[model samples]
Target: MMCDLETGICGPAGEGNSEMELIDLTAPTKKIDLYYVTDPICSHCWALEPTLRKFLEEYGQYINLHTLMGGLLEKWDGFADVSNGISGPGDVAGHWREVGDHTRMPIDGSFWFEDPVTSSYIPSRVYKVVQQKDASLAPVFLRKAREAVFPFNKNISNDQLLIDIVNSIGLNGEEIVKESHLPAAQESLQEDFIMAGRLGVRGFPTIIFLNEEQKGVKVVGARPYDNYVQALKQILPEENIQPKAINTLQHVLQKEGLLFSREIEELYNLAQQDVAAFVEKELAADSYIVEEVLGEKYIQLNQ
Candidate 1:
């Protein structure tokens, strides 16, 4: 069902135990559609969230984005054999902290220490359930779960936790709980896993693109924004887009997360001092650009 990547480990690209390929080319289109396949419990997937959000904000109009669930670490039985308990929940606490520091993303390591999760499938499947009722709510619920476990240190594997997340997001908690337990929701998740199989997806964070004719290109792992852009370009060469240059720095600062002087210098061909002054003026106007007075004049995207 899976294949081996260049590495010997059974990669999503590899056809190993999975009966399906990780990406399927059945849907044909002239324009490109990107299927972002990931699981909620995947740490790397969490790291990609901000980048993904930005990418969507910038380029979503050029492409159709779809979300899919790929089951990661389903069987806990055989993990102990090779992992020697290293892959278990008990070991994830330190790993999460290390990754949190590495990525500079705020992740509370206390979830693994306080209440470990048994499986990611439960929450992942719940995403499918929510999607059925309201497709827009799927990603919202998924992010809520991530916030609960990673930043808030709550146990998402607990039923009450899921209910609370549903409630926090202004959804009907009782209905979400009821739908999560329903047979249809489970079946939808099963189909998503099956579809992942056919697509040859081997990892947690995968973006598979299909053009109008359904030509496919797959990207794996937590890569930079350019990688995603390149993948889309490969699929949709006709869509030639350039970032618009504006007079005031506010629009650019609002669109992009942080603006380094060097980046602005390159973008608008402004001298470093001019860019610095422009940024400062924006900050003075309270236009969402703030310069922290710590070390460097850090410009933040307040919006």
Candidate 2:
């Protein structure tokens, strides 16, 4: 199997396509470097959606982020190899049940019971194709794909579904599909796989933080906001990149749903013990955003 040198992927696995290509190191820019290694089909990736978005929204100014598409199981060809079926929508239904208790994000298990997916490559590759053409809209494409599969319950494996998402997200759907077939798009995805292999990335939503100095740290699996911040701080100790402060929390809450105590602590340097009760009181009064209980405390936005 040939390497898709353009996109930095290793091509299909199990065909002796496993080979690592060293990433060309470059001088760090004003923005901190962050790479989010993920696959479209990864359920954990879906669960990490909210935290990742908040991370981007809050820290986007300080960092330049890129997404690497790690190919999970490509097809339903090997049924036994899969814990769930690519063709059998019901096969994945049970997975939702298992993951729901783990991740607070809502997953309508009926999606697998009713609208199972057959392939994740098309949607995943579409991200590469769009990002290659217009790097700015990469996140938009990624979010649209997630919405299509996990929330809207659309089959991203199909061209029509991809087209619909493209149009819905205000992108040129036809061009995206055309590029999905293009050699350039394929190359980008292949290169992404190669990069993932070299990084020893074994799971979805593997976030790598590379500071301006080229020092790197890795966070595996779906994690909270602090997990990312801790990794980033390891690389850039000077980074005072904290969450929105309590005085400013009201503003941040207008946009984001869930808020963590650590975010406030980091962003505003607020003492967690002091602010905890006030935040809870505000939440009880309906002046804040509230979500499920994690520990003795609930996560709330400063609404």
Candidate 3:
């Protein structure tokens, strides 16, 4: 699904017609770069986490992955759409519930029902601040923010709530807060918007593979793991491609900390019917992981 940064709504990617022309590249580079265009609160983006995690685990050494924020929602005002039957936060909760049911992703819709977020800009800006401080830690912070909203039902728009999430992730909250409001942080966020527009990105969870010559392939919306692999291979045909096999449950848990049956199925290309049973059987006999059914079944490494 595509999320409009200007309207702050989710719809099919490239739903509306675009008048912009594609930019031509000069030459191909020696290395490939993966530009991941996403929004913090985008459900489709959240659903693609497993595939993304697996992609990074396998091809991290060969590719440079850049996470760019797609401004999903600017503000709640001036948004009134009765066509799709989504008018307010309550409607959004229902939509989220449907997404969770379809994707098997754990999403607590109470945040939309109880305390709706006014804007996604706050978290998007905060991400730029964290990226500026330490690029590697930015992904961890983003994961925590997603967990807070999706599973924990926490409103991350609140300044204090955002700070709490930063602190919980072992980052200096005070430093993050101080840097988040700086001119440079705002500029960094603006740059993401400009880059998205330049790339003609109309969706969240969009993956663009660009080689040194600037030749690129754009994959929009959340697709299968093989789709991503194909995109990478298309960009880097000469590179030796070695697909990693999922050997044990511990390996998955060590990489993701938390595991969903759907995630395992997608990562390993397992059949849907066997996924739940396999996860349950593994958790039943294993001492390192614990399974919890909070609306949906989730497994995490036992500490």
Best by lDDT: 3
Quote the positional error of residue 64 for candidate 1 in Å: 1.5
Alpha-carbon runs more than 4 Å astray in model 1: 1-30, 80-85, 243-303
lDDT of 2: 0.67
Residue 30 of model 2: what lDDT?
45
- Give the per-residue Cα lDDT of candidate 1 at 256: 47
Off by over 4 Å in 2: 1-30, 79-89, 109-115, 242-303
- Single out the weakest 10-residue window by summed lDDT for candidate 1: 289-298
Tens-place lDDT per residue, model 3, 234-301, is 88898766655555776667655676766777666788678666776766555555464446556677
Ranked candidates (lDDT, high to low): 3, 1, 2
| True-vs-predicted CA distance for residue 268, candidate 2, Å | 13
Give the Cα error of residue 200 in candidate 3, in Å: 0.9
Per-candidate TM-score against the hidden true structure: 0.70, 0.67, 0.79
In the range 267-296, model 1's lDDT, one tens digit per residue, is: 455675686666665565555554532122
RMSD of each: 15.9, 15.1, 15.8
Which should have the higher TM-score, number 1 or number 2?
Answer: 1
